[model samples]
Target: MKDDCPWFLGYSGGKDSSALLKLVIIALSELTSYHKEITVIYCDTGVENPVITDYVYQTFENLKSECLKLCLPIKYKIAVPKLDDRFFVKVIGRGYPTPTNIFRWCTDKMRINPVKQIIDVHPKATVLLGIRNGESKQRDRTISKHSKSEYYLSQSGSKRNQIFSPIINHSIKDIWSTLKFNNFPKSIDSQKLGELYKDAGSECPVYRELPGKSCGSSRFGCWTCTVVRKDKSISKMIENGYSQLTYLHEFRNWIAEFRDNTEYRCAQRRNGQIGLGPITLEGRKVILDKLLDVELKSGIALLQKEELIRIKELWQSDLKNPNYIEKTAHSRVVKVKTHPKPPI
Candidate 1:
């Protein structure tokens, strides 16, 4: 509740976050006359697009310079998710399946955990989020819930070290307008950022099911995201001549093809009943075997290497029990171009 409590600004290097940062800085400058300390936090997922990472660094530098000019005590911190702690690690290493829409597991592990740790360290801080109502229906629900909490908690919850979204009420148009009005700091490469957004065909793959709902800003996301059906941001990189991203694009396809594999999935539900649908474990396993073949050719592991080894081990163990493995693995239809055979 104290005004002196530090502020944690969550900057994801996206348009919303960038705009929020600018607004937060503007507000802090006015409040600095009264002595306020604001710190910026960027959760690094290690899988952020390179361009996004560059912009984040550049923007931080610009903010630092501005703080120095104004004699403010705002600091910047970056947090990263460990590779061993990723979804692949769990799926490949521990025999957990990839997170699905109904059972989304990546968010809590990757996105929320890293940032929450930083927030927990500074319990007496006002967290600055970059949620804009225009982003999505879910965002609207989140903002509405927080707004209600603000009133019940008192003082728009501003007096408490509560979450504050400065631009929550603003529309997407308003964000661009504000940035344009101020000629946005040179630290951000607006042109390239614009291009990235235009090409970003999907949303952050942290939360499952919503493909094309997230965009790759500059940083902080899982390197292997199968949830995103089309990774336009990575594709953009390839389009712009960043050939390394080609592997990423191919990897996504490999995962997609593998998701339907029967050999890789269980025939019976965890409850031990053969599912009653055309989409049975047998079918899934068959698809998975074909997918595995493609993945082998592609050399992209959907799960981590350790996870894969464990899965294979499980398959071996399951084989001992005839009813367990059941040879659920099946083949998929592969189109092959053929030439006329010579007469025998």
Candidate 2:
């Protein structure tokens, strides 16, 4: 028999998500006849580290294939934002500045909105989030607020969708205990994930920053993230022998540098405030050129073909507009190491 309410687990290829995935499987497995569907959704932000991206796909594939062989009623897919809403298009085509902590717009447009759409379509579904109390005080508060019920309801249109967090109050030690008890998905590196957490480092619009500490060894976010003073994850990865990510670190730094330079930004904000708006046309082009060069050298397609196509179209359209202006361009070269093969 099928349960009326399906479970939607959000997997971000991180430690919390991995542990949550294991718990969900163990729970379902215990109820041998539980035939209702469980869907796992992965939001690929296109700008993810190539190595991380590869791991995510490979792991998901292994899980899917294994589930089929085991005859487990599980379904999974990678969710992607529309082409126009993708990271590269918004930056190069729309000339939007890279996201910052003050006005971090990418989370809503590229990550949350797509998942919201899923919720709207799948009524009565319980979305499983992998949030742990040890991560932040804000998270602790959210868990406390929702503690009264096993299923926390969300208003999506006319229907009420439920939110469930199995490990909301779990500390790092508690989480490891559960993982040790359950049979983890084959692709997950349980030992490495545990060690990474020992070293250092989302929800209803999760504050990118945690409560007590700033980002450290566990910050596995976009290589292009400029919201903080630095993206220590990519830096750590490079130091740990992932030399391929060195160019990304430099590219992200360049974006931060360019944003601070008045010459590469608009004279006025969209609201006419005495501040910058989108990045200048010339600067956007420079970024695109450098990105393409990196793609060629690294042997991995950095920006999608559709993003480039739309960027060219948008650039042309912007040129025809009388209000648009072009700033001076500068010559530069991006340095990158060659990868033996694409990180597929």
Highest TM-score, which number?
Answer: 2
lDDT of 2 by residue, 1-344 (tens): 44668778887777778888887776665675865678888877787667767777887888888778777778886777888888889988888888776767777677666766676577778777777765667646645655544444322233356666677667777777766666555656676565444333522222122233322123445667777677676777777777888777788888877767666666655454555666666667788889888777767678887888999888666655555543222212211122122211
Instruction: Residues 92-136, candidate 1: write the lDDT tens digits.
Output: 433344555554566666666676667666667667776656566
For model 1 the local lDDT of residue 275 reads 41
TM-score of each: 0.67, 0.84
Candidate 2 regions off by >4 Å? 146-159, 192-218, 270-274, 325-344
Q: Among these predicted structures, which one has the highest lDDT?
A: 2
Which regions of candidate 1 deviate over 4 angstroms? 31-34, 82-84, 149-161, 199-223, 265-344
lDDT for every model?
Answer: 0.54, 0.66
